[model samples]
Target: MNAESRDRLRVTVARSFDHVVMAMTLRGVTYLGEQRAPYNEEYDGNDLVAASHLIAWRGSEPVGVLRLRWFADFAKVERAAVLPTFRRHGVMRALMQEALRYSARRGYRQVLGHAQLNRVAYWRSHGFRVRPGRPSFMFSDYEYVEIEHPLERPANAITMDSDPLAIIRPDGDWDRPGPFDRSLRRAPRKQRRPEELA
Candidate 1:
């Protein structure tokens, strides 16, 4: 892709159901259609709970997706997919970088993923390495090995010390005021008298 076109690619958290659907569509095309991965195995019940989806958009086209699930001290990366047509343009790399940044911002120091045996080198290119001594495993007719990447905690990572409003801001959008922040502008409700309550 040209520099101008590459510059148009933006990775953002999937904040709404529509955004999640777009991510699912890319995964469906790549995994379900191309790879013939089983539907149950691919959509493993965890999508809507305790997970953050990242979508890479080249202008208005949703070209790539990555799912991140948070753990106490680590973040698990799963279901990374990019449209076949967009594979050579660094869409996966962009998604990986955004996932790392988002994880670090939330105070996660390690990121883990199950890399298909054939894709180990691709994961390694992004600084992930197979965990030593971990046995290879198989799922959905594919062999996989666990890989991990370490991250340095960012200085601005959210913590108990952060402002309460900042903590409640939308995922990966802590820098801007969110709907809750804007709602603070409304006047407080007046207290009802005992006579009015009766």
Candidate 2:
């Protein structure tokens, strides 16, 4: 894609339900359902925040996605995907680079991810290191190895709470709790009785 089209590719925070559907569908097709929770679980915006769902849109249609989870010292990257038509054209790499740059800008000490066994070399080429230990998660039949990228400075972390390109802060304790937590705490608003409604 050209710079203009690439620049037009908007990455925005999305609701967890949409994200979950996308994630589950993509993972299921790729045989990574073992890594996913059941799809019937309800979710809310806060759940999306905790997961840091960044939906890549080409105009109005979402074509790619990536999720981020930030902690006090580090950020975790996961569930990255790009639609078939968008693959091999640097969409996934662009999303990752943006996420890494964002993490570095947010003051996170590092950015970490669990790469599928088949993608270990791909991650290695991007400067990630495999942690020497057993896998903590599984994607399809493959195990995932922890990989991390250390940041040189806290100032390099991405700050998503601001304008124009505003994003949900991965860190907890913003104006509101993140999407994932919201999902956990969400309760249906009670409807008013007829008398109360009147």
Candidate 3:
């Protein structure tokens, strides 16, 4: 499949409804580890659901993922990940452009994202300005910066029709849990040791 078809990007509300959450988590951990950043294996599907999840797939397999949430006046973009084989083919750019356009349509005045330190310049090229004198999210372990873009009327008004292959369901109701919820709920919790707790 070509890059565009391989991406097969779709926006949805439920992470558990689709099987790509596992692929996204694995790719995130692997990518973060390569950059010497922290990756929590215990991260739950709830985190993915809280944000608007966009997933890209190649045929039946997921290859890229991104998340976005509207907070007051701005839309916060997070967790943009594209597999190594899918990178540099304008995948991330296409995703971001779509997100910005979506945010504008939803009445957001700005779009913001916490850019990993290494990607600051890349974001700058997309018209994001780095804020000065703001507290950093990464603390001392790794460098990270906040980037923001003022959505001009022109860019915000553009819209693209949704893709059919990216459509997981007809009603766009992905918030409901799938088989994972039933299995996790059935699993017994581990008992704590008194000495270990102390």
Q: Which has the greatest TM-score? A: 1
The C-alpha lDDT values of all candidates are 0.93, 0.64, 0.63
Q: Which candidate, 1 or 3, has the higher lDDT?
A: 1
Tens digits of per-residue lDDT, candidate 3, 1-198, equal 787765565433334654455545645654565544555532335454435766655555665666777587788887777877777876677667777766675557798888878889999887788877886687436678888988865532323443322223322332344444455568688998899899
Tens-digit lDDT track for model 1 on 2-86? 7688559889999999999998999999999999988998899989989999999987789999999988889999999999878
Q: Report the Cα lDDT for residue 109, model 1.
A: 93
Winner on TM-score between 1 and 3 is 1
lDDT for position 24 in model 2: 43
Number of backbone collisions per candidate: 0, 18, 0
Q: Sort the candidates on lDDT, descending order.
A: 1, 2, 3
Better of 2 and 3 by TM-score: 3
lDDT winner between candidates 2 and 3: 2
What is the Cα-based lDDT of residue 168 in candidate 1?
Answer: 92
The worst-scoring run of ten residues by lDDT in candidate 2 lies at 164-173
Scored against the true structure, residue 74 in model 2 reaches a CA lDDT of 86
